[model samples]
Target: MSSAEAAVPQAQWWHSFYGGLQKMGRSLQLPVAVLPAAGILNRLGQPDVFGKDGLGWNNVAKVFAAAGGALLDSSLGLPMLFCIGVAIGMAKKADGSTALAAVVGFLVYYNVLRAFPEACKAPTVLVGNQCIDYASLKAAAATYQNPGVLGGILIGLMSAWLWVRFHRTKLVDWLGFFNGRRLVPMITALVGMLFACLSVWVWPPIGDGMTSFGQWLSDLGSWGSGIFGVANRALLLVGMHQLLNTFLWFQFGEFTKADGSIVHGDIPRFLAGDPTAGQFTSGFFPIMMFALPAAALAIAHSAKPHRRKEIYGLMTSVALTSFVTGVTEPIEYSFAYVVPALFAVHAVLTGVSMAVTWALGVHAGFTFSAGLIDYVINWGLATKPWLIMPIGLCFAVVYYAMFRFIIIKFNLKTPGREDEDEVEDVTKA
Candidate 1:
């Protein structure tokens, strides 16, 4: 056989699926890394940061809030970030023009939707079924917020892919005016318009579906949140869970504020000072704040005594990352890559944690991940905040015991416990 044919082995469908996920995870790094700074800014600016006593810095708080919130909450900010981040991440050359083209394409996509709402609406999914929340849906058409981050991601990837394909194409001399990078943005715009028009025709049913799903999840109450929590962790394995967050956190509800004003999305409503913001997010506190760190400790403890120090160093850094920022992927993927079964258990535990917390009627909001920073930031506005610490401690013990037993029993190679070559490699890191 030829060298290429001999080296390449056919794989099952699951191999392709996993390969795609790994690629997605790599592409997400840039966008994800930028979140911490914005999150910190938002935490600083949130009300009650200075407490009821620090009345003097109230204006300062507002200034900080505006400064940070602008990056996330502003119209251009998030879409632009996604476009550029995804473009750079996916491009082989990582060209600046690729990123610029992506941004322009994304804007063109939304601009079309905004300019012609009626033309965009598909026939009602059930003909007579309410396609979407009428007033809010209409508002979204004007504001063009429903497409959201998922929309930005779709456009970003498309723009980048188009740039890569046609960027170096050579045109005849007569048509040379529209050659190279100059041709990219224009073609990207046309593609964006096509997708936007398609969205106009296609999104009604999808929007209706999103609305129905949100309503169903809300109706299921804590149980629904628990299932959502499980799905969240499991999907995170493939780096797709953020898509669900877009619906639940941002596009789910017509949340009303204390002033009798209404807004869509949990985050925007919470920032508007709504108290119901935490139902979907609060469940993560126990898992991130206590359970994951505890699990990390267990993994370290299970390592051979000679390797304990090295294991401790790696786990300690990742565990700290998880606890402080709710960035669990580092610690999670470390083990999940080696012991897939253990990851399943982690996902299940996350569901139970969310259910238990929601059942107890605790609520807390976070702009970032469900890390300690967000938990503390929203605590003053949270429901049953005091119960979180005690409950979290209980979870800590449970995760520790469970992870230790499973890893030891299975001899799972979780970081420090890897075989000879893996051990040396992990220690170096």
Candidate 2:
């Protein structure tokens, strides 16, 4: 094939892959948006808070914790939530049928996995009577590591695909009731069973490998965290950061609570009271709450004297948004395209912040972004909440100095620095 012909197929593949990632990223937000509620409720019920003796709200704390635990607990929590969210989000149309099918499919898949070992023969047998070892089977089943959110995501995507393909299917006269969207759940139930059976053999190795990989990431410590930080920001440039987050925040690690229920991923583990749960997430406090906001100030300061007023309001709004809500998109997009090098510098600084906080043994968790709201709400759960302020202050200085120097030295066209016509266009917008 000619070079152009070869490139056509490659380009198509790239677009297809990119499109899928974008869809998954958007779909993931549905489930993620509920996390803050879970975090707040869980924190409210902890012993150090309203649950304590002097607080005179011990029973109230239990109620709040139970309500929150219903969302974060292993049995019917995040994994199941993801299934419903992803299914509806990814389907051609967000329908109740899709969400219902996702839940049914996940339950069937999960129960089948649990029930399979008992139904099958055990590896060991008694030589005397050649009896099947039911005890071993039960033990084996107990030892099975639930795939957790990863499994939920897999089944959710499958259900969505099924919905897209069969939501309009016709059926024979006698089977009319199961036609179109209604058929989706029935078909998913069978598919879920099949996947469960297949998972008996297919999932063990994959699960083990994933567990080992999680361990490896934990062992990498600051280096793994820094890499994640850099990638998180860089990927945000293309709106793919959610894909990265869904894995790290929802499926990265495994922790078993005192009650024997296991929680997976950094966020869930943290909510479950795992002491080491926040390493992958804590670093963002400095970057989002301080550094990027300071960068916003630098951009506003470097603008032409006459143009500063025009851009100051925009900069200030984004800065406060970053500080209070940890939403940095408004600030990032301003310079992401105008001066790509600054974005690269911003990404690197983010990585440094991650590494520093991680090395300093500072641990914090957030259900959403590293905003002041989450910082305060989750303060009791953090190892060194006060340390974040000091770290954030340092990052503020660095971000301000670096951004100002770069803007001035390179004469970069950030916000108000555009040519007169361009500035007029921006200002008018």
Candidate 3:
């Protein structure tokens, strides 16, 4: 094993500190979790109770409904909170400097795309004859929007990196007030904005290329769903899934509403909330919520008798995290390092999950992972949330059983299945 692999056992102070920040970020989601529930309640009955009249009990209900919606949007909106969440969770040191840097990076990314002329212009393919005048294109280009989540995440990563880079820079005396953490965020934000502005000015075609790519992916339909599933898992390794998600969910497609208005946003709105939106997320519910957890259990059961307890503890935490927050790294990494085939199987299962959901039109959405919390939230608010649970549970059982059987039959080198030498050392140690 490499030094990095061995280092995993060290449990460095930085790891603990970062873990604490992640835990805090996780806790922050609880209150935000309430927003989805409230939105569901209002959607179900509030509108009817608050008549369409300008003023009355119905109007009162509308006010409440609107307030709830706004609160949910502001608090839980991925773009609004992604920077803070990521910065806090991923930063080596939990400080205001990192958080502020993330914010700066996000703003830079947003404004850069927003200012891109090509970004504003609608695709000629979509708007054929309507694209007559260059003036219209210019107007449209000026109105282009950014993939907020993508921008935010990039900003957060950049900010964190910048903080680390400048934390020890000399010139502390001359730039005393702007040194350290405070200086990092300030510098990051300024740099990001400047980069964004320059990119827009120098590379108008880049935005157009991205728009084209999004459209191409959108056109893939069921194949697109499968690709997304595979891609999502792959990106998870590098923590870039959020960026892919932004393109697919928000930038690439247009969702038509019941009243004939078209809107652009993330996949969750279309799959779980919007009445007229397509069921884009129908495919993920099964793999994320059920299958992966089952696999975790299977690996646990197959663990060596001596290591079983430790493996079980790890798997249990991973399973709960997967179910609750949809974060699956703990689980994926558990077997991925030791058993490559199992990871491949896991990836295949993910694709299968998406294909099944897409074929059934069982749409769902999640703020985090495809776990139960998001399932419940989306289901409660979705037009067909009930279908997801039944389907997901069935897959979960299959995953667990198959994984268990495979480990025993193949003698897979999963967690807790180390060689005799290691096992002896572990026992002795």
For lDDT, the strongest prediction is 2
Backbone clashes in candidate 1 total: 1
- lDDT for predicted candidate 3 compared with the true structure: 0.61
Q: Give Cα distance to truth, residue 84, candidate 2, Å.
A: 1.7
Clashes of each: 1, 0, 5
Better of 1 and 3 by TM-score: 1
lDDT of each: 0.75, 0.84, 0.61
TM-score to true structure, per model? 0.81, 0.90, 0.66
Shift of residue 389 alpha carbon in model 3, Å: 3.5
Per-residue alpha-carbon lDDT of model 2 for 88-118, expressed as tens digits?
Answer: 8888866899998998899999888766442
What stretches of model 2 exceed 4 Å from their correct place?
117-141, 423-429
Tell me the spans in candidate 3 whose CA falls farther than 4 Å from its real position. Answer: 1-80, 83-94, 101-142, 145-147, 154-193, 202-204, 237-240, 256-265, 275-280, 300-321, 415-417, 424-429
In model 1, the Cα lDDT at residue 236 comes to: 85
TM-score of 3: 0.66
Clashing pairs in 3: 50-58, 51-58, 120-140, 120-141, 121-141
Error of 1 at 295 (Å): 1.1
Structure candidate 1, residue pairs in collision? 250-265
RMSD for all candidates, in order, please: 5.8, 4.3, 8.0
Residue range 1-429, candidate 1, lDDT tens digits: 887675556544567777655555567567756655765675667656742444547777777766766666524556566667777777668687898789789888878877653422543221222234454553222234346555777787888788888888778999898888878988999998898888877877887888898889878878888888999888887777765676677556766544343455666555556666666787888899889999899999999888899889989998999999888888888888788888898889888888888888887767768888777766666789888888899989999998999999988888777777654443453
Query: How good is model 1 by TM-score?
Result: 0.81
